[model samples]
Target: MYFAKRNSEEPEIVIENTVVYACESASCNGWMRKDFASENYVCPMCGSQLIEEVRELPKIQTDFNSFK
Candidate 1:
């Protein structure tokens, strides 16, 4: 896991958190980080349509420790 570092020495600054597309279907628990989402998004778990969702999550940065 390696996030593109915009600045090597500067701290990560996420002014706005990412918007993920999650399955709105009650039977599914699938979502994709918008950055990695495809053109036509669908639930990875149940193949249902997706909808915009804002989760109370901290900004995620790709790093070796995160993969671990």
Candidate 2:
């Protein structure tokens, strides 16, 4: 009997020691890695200013230095 390939059940991956920035506007859901965020800390999608925040999100690997 031939068996078809089955999807592997893997747990979600988590990242550590990350800094992020989130929109300060009350009606926005914008957020990004501080290092990769806009130069002015503005939310590109909502045009709102950003603030430093701690969050758990999918890790994004980038070569750009986030520090100013």
Candidate 3:
């Protein structure tokens, strides 16, 4: 049996310790990146409080031009 090789290789994903806001409610799984979080640390999903946390997250490129 022979296997065919792919033409291109997948890009490597970069991960880093990123600060985020997590919901305090046990039933809610709402979270947002620190940089994108609003002044208020309120959970939009369940109206609960959000706490600061550090998580290993993949690096993302932001497009500021897209925002109005």
Error of 3 at 57 (Å): 0.6
lDDT of 2 at 44: 87
**Alpha-carbon lDDT, every model:** 0.78, 0.77, 0.92
Clashes, model 2 = 1
Could you tell me which 10 consecutive residues in candidate 3 have the lowest summed lDDT? 59-68
TM-score, prediction 2? 0.61
* Candidate 1 lDDT tens digits, 1-68: 99886865877566556688999899788888776788887787888999998765556667743665
Backbone atom clashes (below 3 Å) for every candidate: 0, 1, 0
Instruction: Give the Å error, residue 56, model 1.
Output: 2.0
Summarize candidate 2's per-residue lDDT along 1-68 as a digit string, tens digits. 99998879886776666778888999988888767665887788888888997876666655564433
Q: What is the C-alpha RMSD of each candidate to the true structure, in Å?
A: 10.8, 4.2, 4.3
Residue 60, model 2: Cα distance from true site in angstroms = 4.4
Highest lDDT: which candidate? 3
The TM-score that candidate 1 achieves is 0.58
Q: What are the runs in model 3 whose C-alpha is more than 4 Å off?
A: 1-7, 64-68
C-alpha lDDT of residue 2 in model 3: 95
